[model samples]
Target: MRNGNRRGKPVEKARHFWPTTKRLISYLRPWKWGVLLSILMAIVSVALNIVSPKILGQATTDIYDGILKGVQQMKLGLHITKYPIDFNHVGQICLIVVALYILSGLFSFGQQVLMTWISQKVVYNLRQDFKEKMGRLPIKYYDQHSNGDLMSRMVNDMDNISGTLQ
Candidate 1:
């Protein structure tokens, strides 16, 4: 049906979603390792992103405490011999937060690349299988189905499948 409409025809619903889903998943069997690795990378990236904010908060707290201490010393009218702020500690915390963010970004990028590669490979294999099946089909099948519908299934549907996989 074009645009989800079949004129006077009734709509068809999926009667076995789980079985269909399992079949789709079978296509990913060859690249299971890649899928697992991509999932791991995504988890690590999210964890790093989550932890960085807390680390940065520690630095903010340090700065605030240092400023408060300096203000107190000023009120006491004592000669401030040393700076209240421990710049070294704050600097180290900032560096750690920066490193974490960079690592998170790297992991995220790696996940995207791996997933895209896996999805494209799956789509390529599927297209090859479809071509082979089409070649074996009887000529009568072609006469019954429109060329546009066949091409739509061959190209657009495969592209949609690839997108869904990614």
Candidate 2:
């Protein structure tokens, strides 16, 4: 009564249809915050801190070429009252530039803190949900599978998720 050229046994088909992945994805709701935080941190780290330095450097170059050079030219002219500008005021301007560099570093530090918070929170919630779901599944199910396989899914998969977040 079975099909005409069946290659494998019915039991083999049953063995291949494991339900681990579908079961796991159902419990991933609470970890969204961590995922969002990770994306935010990555974007901020790349865009703000990295890109800002190049932009600031260009701005500094413009100031040096246009304003600083103009001041030098004006100082050399006899009509100083008409084009009054000081070249000896580099001390205060240098301090301001240093402060901007410090501020950029602070932005990077803040992003790291946010990323760590998200990664830890997501991994903790994911582990907790995984354990809870595993506990609820019937014991008869475990009888069909190896303990090592079950443990690998519970521990190793979660560790992989956390490592990936990093």
Clashes of each: 0, 0
List TM-score per model, in order: 0.85, 0.50
Q: Per-residue lDDT tens digits of candidate 1, residues 52-163? A: 9999999899889998888899889976876588889999999999999999999999999999999999999988998899999999999999978898867987888889
Mind sharing the TM-score for model 1?
0.85
Model 2: per-residue lDDT, tens digit, 1-166? Answer: 2643366544324333347445434444465665566567556555655655565565566556666656787768734443333334444555555665666566567656765666567678877777898899899888998878878876876777666555
Q: Which stretches of candidate 1 lie over 4 Å from their true place?
A: 1-15, 79-83
Candidate 2 Cα deviation (angstroms), residue 28: 7.8
User: Can you tell me which runs of candidate 2 are displaced by over 4 Å?
Assistant: 1-47, 50-52, 55-97
The 10-residue segment of model 2 with minimum total lDDT is 78-87
TM-score of 2: 0.50
